[model samples]
Target: MSGQHHVMVVDDEAAARDMVGEYLSLHGFRVTLCDGGPALRRAMATERADLVVLDLDMPGEDGLSVLRDIKRRAPVPVIMLTATAAPTDRIVGLEVGADDYLAKPCELRELLARVRALLRRLAAPAAVPGSAGRTETVRFGTKILDLAAHVLRDDEGRELPLTASEFSLLKAFAENPRRVLSRDRLLDLAGARDPDAFDRAIDVRITRIRRKIEPDPDTPAYIKTVRGAGYMFMPEGETR
Candidate 1:
């Protein structure tokens, strides 16, 4: 990782653009501010960026559209900012591959923390030697998950649309193949601070994921429920 990271700040508000850009610049980052999607695309074409700070609400091409384009064009880390604070919106953003998210009216310090966390996660070395450059795709039962691209494809090769929480939960299972991970451990991995608030939330996400990946969601084949424990991914060779 370079000492001076390049970050693109995308927001329609002038004050926000300046504030975020200036704050990041002060922290030793090279910042570029864009008012909308078109300007952002133009800037991206000219320079490679290490990260993107994107606003969810925007005129013309919205932030989500821009986020999709970014995922398609480049695998740069993205930290989404939204004013709504809606769980659905947050889930959608994560599902579509955002590295992190911050609700609007957030403290500058909190935003900075999210930015640092995203970058650190992106820069972290792979768990195994030679795994860094390997494509991160996991297959279970009738579904395939592309971690790098954040796409979930069914057995028939159709993409399954998932919410952010669902995607994150599924990814956690896929990465730890065949391991029984408890709710507390999962909350930590998902970056959620309150485990109780997210207790049934993870269950909901898992059920949603099972609907997409399982041959029979009612009696799930891949993601199995451990009666006394949490959840486990029963890979082909693993016993249920």
Candidate 2:
């Protein structure tokens, strides 16, 4: 990604879309504006966008649905914008693969900070291969994580589709299995900062991961909660 990164701003609100698009353009990003999810889909087909400034509330095919679709089809970094600051909504956004969420009535400065943070994270280097004799595959329950490909798959060999952030978070936990990881630690490892008032967003992501890999998501056998401590990943076997 270059200094003149391309960003797609998806928002139905004309004023809000213009404001964000203009600000990002002024700050050296090449921005393309879209009024709805359909327009966004069209724009994506033509150009590769480095990031997305997505609005949560839209007249049709609302932001959450778009978020899920984007995560599934293309794993681009997204900063979600919503008027409601409800914790449940924020959790859902993060769970479904929004990289960051901002409440509406938000300050431009804060949004800019979040955008920069997300871009920087996406640009981070992948984990390097260790020395000879190091563990290559991480196993938890019936799932296998391939660090190099950044993918998780079940015993049946079905690949679990995960967004970039979710893959990074799972890799962090798999690399340090069976150890309690605090929210702050997980954020640092995932190359993302904790969003405002949504620290439990990590837990939500973990729950989503469990649903894919664990036999029982409600009583997860792989990633276990450690009361107030945080979470611990129980690997099938000890790391060599």
Candidate 3:
């Protein structure tokens, strides 16, 4: 299964990039190693990678900028490697469209685990929403989330790009409407729970999702925060 997918490792540090590239290669994945942003850009132009392991603390054209560019250019999943201990870097990376992040000097096994989990998600078949069947699409405001297709469509039927993480969260909410779900419960439902995930990771993801599905993200209607509890999915956008 891993043999079919291509993984790209982009880091300024030669040792780190080579280490990851070799490890992934050993695991039967086709791996590409890029020294920096320019190499990454060139590689992306020539071939599509199933996933990217991007280093956040590079010298020029930094990871955040590169992440933004990647999100704008493609829907490929990205996992950021940040050396900074500050939560701000992780938060900003998440906001800029990193599907996930890991601290620097991370364990090789853990990295491989993350890579496998994300690939599984990408390869997983579209789930049938409920036993009733055929009700695959759910509408929130003007946007529509298609469960079977794993894509979000605007009212005009144009596709809006959603990272695997975002789509998983939205699908979780759609499956359990009108129920207040705690952060842990939400992650469990979405199959995205990470031990290293920050407390506000879910909040950041919710904010991002709101921007796409809410008429007014500042005062979200579809996914409402339940104060101390968690969040509730109001399918009808009910105020009361």
Candidate 4:
């Protein structure tokens, strides 16, 4: 992929949209501005975007709905924006498939950095055959993670769709099994955009991964949340 990517900015504030659009434009992204969800839908209908910078506080069709719609309509990466640093909004955004997020009243430089981080992560090369051996994969329970294929498959060969963040997080966990991974270290090892230690970004991604790999997400076997310490990923047979 080229360094340039098409980004759609959906914000009710015209000034915010213009500013973000122009900033991204100057940074080599082709950007489109949308005033609301309807315009967002129209733009996506016209052409698929590489990423979306969406504001959460839109009228009529809120960003959560738009995020859901985007995932349902297309699986493009999205970065959500909110005016307040509210944990509820951030957590909800992640649950609804936003790839990353930033609080409003943020510096343009920070936003640019986050955009680049996510784009770079998305552009990372997949695992491919290089040696005279089978492609390396890790097994947790009945699910096998094809590191090169970037996919999780079941014993029955059913595929689970993982977002870029989830895939990266699971890879990190598999590589460092039986170790308590702090949220900061997980983000660092996973090549994710660093959020605050208190941010629920890492937790949300972990939850999503558990839902796929665990027989029961509520009480996970592979990925266990260690109270106040972080999380530990159990390697196969460790439980016994």
Best by lDDT: 3
lDDT of 4 by residue, 54-92 (tens): 999888888999999988886678888998666776788
Identify the superior model by TM-score, candidate 1 or candidate 2. Answer: 2
TM-score to true structure, per model: 0.69, 0.82, 0.93, 0.84
For each candidate, the alpha-carbon lDDT, in order, equals 0.74, 0.78, 0.86, 0.79
lDDT of 3 by residue, 167-194 (tens): 8788788878888889888766554345
Q: What is the model-wide C-alpha lDDT for candidate 4?
A: 0.79
Error of 4 at 182 (Å): 1.2
Taking all chains together, the TM-score of candidate 4 against the true structure is 0.84
Q: Model 1 over residues 44-90: C-alpha lDDT tens digits?
A: 99999888999998888888999998878876778888898557776
Q: What stretches of model 2 exceed 4 Å from their correct place?
A: 1-4, 128-137, 154-158, 191-199, 237-240
Predicted candidate 2 versus true structure: per-residue lDDT over 14-51, tens digit per residue: 99999999988888889999999999999999999888
Model 1 Cα displacement at 193 (Å)? 5.8
Q: Could you tell me which 10 consecutive residues in candidate 1 have the lowest summed lDDT?
A: 122-131
The TM-score measured for candidate 3 stands at 0.93
In terms of TM-score, the best-performing candidate is: 3
- For model 3, what is the C-alpha lDDT against the true structure? 0.86
For model 1, how big is the CA root-mean-square deviation?
5.0
Candidate 4 clash pair list: 127-148
What order do you get sorting by lDDT, best first? 3, 4, 2, 1
